[model samples]
Target: MDRQDCQHLLAALGEYIDGTLDEELCREIEKHMAECENCRVVVDTLRKTIYLYRVEAQEESLPQEVRHRLLARLELEG
Candidate 1:
């Protein structure tokens, strides 16, 4: 796959991992991945990173004061 094709597929990679991509798009990505080791590695790394973050974020608790301060800062910025 060309750079543009890889770029296009990269945007859909997250959706593909989440099983939210349509079948046709999934097939297209699969086809591209078959011939593109680099893109496959990109997809694999992205998936693993997202999974790791999900697990870590769930296991770790954010302090309530920190959460309130962040929300207040966002509100002020908005």
Candidate 2:
């Protein structure tokens, strides 16, 4: 797949993770991820982020340093 395909995959990633996508589409994504290291890393990071919010961060905001680091990593820091 080309860069455009990766963008398309990334666009659908949230739905893929939320289990809102069709099984066939999910299979396509998983197949793509299996061969794409960049996509795999993105998917893993997103999954962990979701897990953290649902499990750990649900009780409170992310620890201050973590929030700052995440924001910086996204280049969203002020």
Candidate 3:
């Protein structure tokens, strides 16, 4: 994968996966992915990873240390 061509796509991919990216950019990313196998793999892997995390989070609580760190990172510990 040519990094230059993929740089912008990588930056927006998270937002794209979350459905928060704008329509025009999303279309462009989709078009790019159609021709770029590496980007398709990246997007697919992220989608699957996020899906698994959501499923597991719904079923189980985080360990205390993990929970504490997460809360602290998010500035929600207070």
For 12-76, candidate 3 gives per-residue lDDT tens digits of 87799889999999999998999899999989998999899999889896699999999999999
Question: Candidate 1: worst 10 consecutive residues by lDDT?
Answer: 69-78
Q: Check candidate 3 and list the clashing pairs.
A: none
The 10-residue segment with the lowest total lDDT in model 3 = 1-10
**Which ranking of candidates, highest TM-score first?**
3, 1, 2
- Residue 67, model 2: lDDT of 93
Whole-model Cα lDDT of every candidate shown, in order: 0.89, 0.86, 0.89
Per-residue lDDT of model 1, residues 1-76, tens digit only? 4688899897898789999999999999999999889999988998899889999989898898898899898895
Q: Which candidate is the best by TM-score?
A: 3
- Candidate 1: clashing residue pairs, number: 0
Question: lDDT by residue for model 2 over 1-78, one digit each (tens)?
Answer: 367768879889889988999998898889888889999898899899878878975677568999999999999999
TM-scores, all candidates, are 0.66, 0.65, 0.71
Q: Model 3 misses residue 46 by how many Å? A: 0.4
